[model samples]
Each structure stands twice: as structure tokens, then as C-alpha cells.
Target: MTDSYDRVAVVTGADSGIGKATAVLLAEHGFDVGITYHEDEEGAWETAALVREAGKAAAVRRHDLTDPVRAAHVVDELAGELGGIGVLVNNAGTGSSEPLLGMDYERWRSVLSVDLDGPFLCAQRAARRMATEGRGGRIVNVTSVHEEYPRVGAGPYCAAKGGLKLLSRVLALELAVYGITVNTVAPGEIATPMTGQEDRVPRAGSRPGYPIPRPGDAREVAAVIAFIASPAASYMTGSSVFVDGGMVTMGPQAAGALQSGDWR
Candidate 1:
């Protein structure tokens, strides 16, 4: 295997939020980025412009993770345009807010397919290419705090993210031989379109329930991803890093201070 990989990265869902920040940060870190968007071609172009502004090459494409088979090919397409992929950030995802009983099979399946199945297929394709080229690579799956903690109304989202965390671990173990590291970055409530907080900056006292007492910024989550994809994290793999502003640590405290059963 090659000792060092190429400085090329493919980030899905780069049109906005964590994906966009990650792509730009990676570009600033001396990587040529391949950006993909679902229905935000304009936003993707904006991200591409920022990448080029950072003095790196940027390639944009439309990637619909709902169609996992076709979407996974976007990896190859970007890799072809960028020479090779040294990093794959599986950041495209969807979520559901209805209770299990209220959700139809279609809703549940849609979340599972995009949040879990899409990453699996995309990782498979990227890993195959990395292995064939004999260059080590990095795979970062952007999950959620729900990956470990359940939410009352997000049954399908939790299930998919939880499954993805385990899948990342297995991939880390299997891909280690090829010098590919797989890890998951689980974030709490961030100011992103997914959280209905797009273009909003998190204030210090915004979330009193959280230990940090505020929503996280997309850039904050992206920083950790950039670190894991860099050579500095060479010894890390199969780990789940939580950029959740201590939200995961507040479960017991929150439960103890609950004033009512209204939480249910």
C-alpha cells in the first residue's frame, strides 16, 4: 500500500451546513474537493467557489442519496475528475420527526435508505477505489447524538444513525488492512438546515438544557471532521467523536431536573 494518500476529498451534501463547512476547510488544508448536492445546485456552486477561493480545485455534482446505487457512482465520477479520492465524508442524510406508529413504511424506509444505506454504498465504492489505487483513505460518517441516545419522535432517524455508528466500526476494522480509517462524528443540535436553523448563529445562552447552553455551529462540527481526515489523526479509527457541546453528558442531569412528564 502507498504510504501517503492523495490530497483529494469528496464530500456529499456540500451545498450547505456541516458538509459545506467541511469541504471548504479541507480545501484550505490543501485538498482538492469534490462537492455533491441533492437539490441545491446553486448552493453547491457557491461551495465550489469558496473551495477555489481557498486555492484548491473544486468539482460539483448532483448526488441524490435516496437512490443509493446511482448516488454511489458520484464518488467515482468525482474521483475521476479530481484524479483520486483520499477522503470520503458521508454527510448527506435525512431525518423523520413522527412517532413510529404515526410513520408509514415509506417514511421509515426513506430515512433508513438515505441515512444508512447511502453511506454504506458510497463507502463501499470509495474503499474499492482506494484499495485498487493502493492509497490509504479516510471515511467520516456524520451521524447525530441520536445515534447513541433516542429521541421521542425520531424513531427512524435514531435507528438509522445508531446502525451507522456500528457500521462505521466494522468498516474501520475491515479497512484497517488497507490503511483506510473509518470513524463517525456525531453532533448535537447544530445551526443547519436540517435542524431548521440555517443562517442562524448560535448564541451562548440559546440552549439552557445543554451543558454548553447553546446550539452548535456547523463549522464546529466540520473542524473535528477536518482533523480526523488529516494525517494528525493517523492512529485513530473505529471511534465516534461527539461534537455535541456536552449534550450527551446532560442526560442524567436533565432527567433528574425534569419538572413534569410533559417530556413524554
Candidate 2:
């Protein structure tokens, strides 16, 4: 309420991992933050405490983005609580390890709804508010290296992220006139709670598949997202900033070069 220009960011799935890192980093950069979590209210408050420790205000909420309709409404609710939304990071996502052919219909629908439809709803709702209020916004979708590369058992995740990447570009083109910038951040092999590797930081000898020779930290990816959400990115939109340690560029040759998997 201090100024219409006061920066406020809403990051979904912020209870842990990359989303948590993003909220904390944005706070460090002087943005009031709103964090949403599906079931980990405690983790959400932990993130809030980190934000407060960084000298910024934080609003925490319980959100399930699987419902597109409810997803938009949640954006509206968060905006109301945070004064206005300057940045929206659609980071809530889920993955399926089930094989593509054997995947059930409901399971497939669930993935698409959360990863694609939900972001679409939130983007539409937030962009409308930003354009209408005459305050442009920043939307950074947390996609994956899978947005460009297909994995063995992650067909649904690949499809959803790929769709979101294209959708983000379209939104970037459409929202540019309003001064709103939209972009995608594709991270590869990040060390986050999602990978069940929070206790193990990426070591110099690990992650042989990466050119950098190690998995990235969540903060590493969050830094890229924070930059894109900042005013310095005023002229950049419809872009995909990759934080994949050269994973995607390595191509099939990289996977083919992999010497082993646990089963092997």
C-alpha cells in the first residue's frame, strides 16, 4: 500500500525447493512476497520466516493449482492480500514416472491440469489485472529441460512443459503492449526437495551427464528467474532462459554417453 510501484511477487509451490529459493531471493531483492503451497503449510511459513528475515513481508496460502478455475481465483486472492502482484512465478508442478503407454487417463489429466492449464489460468488472471491497473507485470514460468528434450518415463511432464513454453511466448507477445514481460526458465538436474536430494549438495564429482559436471542448486535457477522478473529485464520477453548447465545442448550424444544407471 505504500506505492503502486512497490514490488510484490507471488510464487507457487514455494513451500520447498526452487519455489522457496525464488521467494527468498525476491525478498532479498526488495520484493514483498506471497507464497502458496498445496499441503505443506509449515514449509510455507518457514519460507515466510526467511522472507521476513530478509526484511520483506510475505503472505502464505494453501493452494492446489490442479483446478484451472480455482487457480485463477487464487491469484486474485493473493493479489488482494499482497496489495498487487508485480511478479507471478508459476512454479507449482508435478511429474509422473509411469510409462507413457501404461499411463491412466486421470493421471494424465492431473499432470496437464497442474502444469499447463493452471499456469494458463493464473497468467490470464494476473495479466488482466496488471494491464487494467496500468501496472505491467512479470511472469516467469518454471519449465524444464524436458521442455525441449523428451525423457524415458516423463512423457506427460514433457508435453505439459512444452505446451507451457509456447503458451508463455504467446503471452509475452500479447502482453508486451501492456509492458508486461513473460518468459520461461528451464532448469536441469537441480538439487531441490523434489529430487529428494536436499541433504546432498551437488558435488564436483557428481552429475556426469552435465557439461558443468554437477547438478545445479535451486538458488542457481532462482537467480535467473529473479533477474528476468527485475526491471533490468524490461526489454526482454518471450524468451526462454535456460539454467540447465548445457544439458539440452549436449543432445542425444550426452545421454548416449552416460556410462551407467542404478540398474546397470
RMSD of each: 1.1, 2.8
Candidate closest to the true structure, highest TM-score: 1
* TM-score, every prediction: 0.98, 0.94
lDDT of each: 0.94, 0.88
lDDT of 1 by residue, 70-142 (tens): 9999999999999999999999999887878888998889999999999999999999998888879899999
How well does candidate 1 match the true structure in TM-score terms? 0.98
* Model 2 clash tally, residue pairs: 0
- Against the hidden true structure, what lDDT does model 1 obtain? 0.94
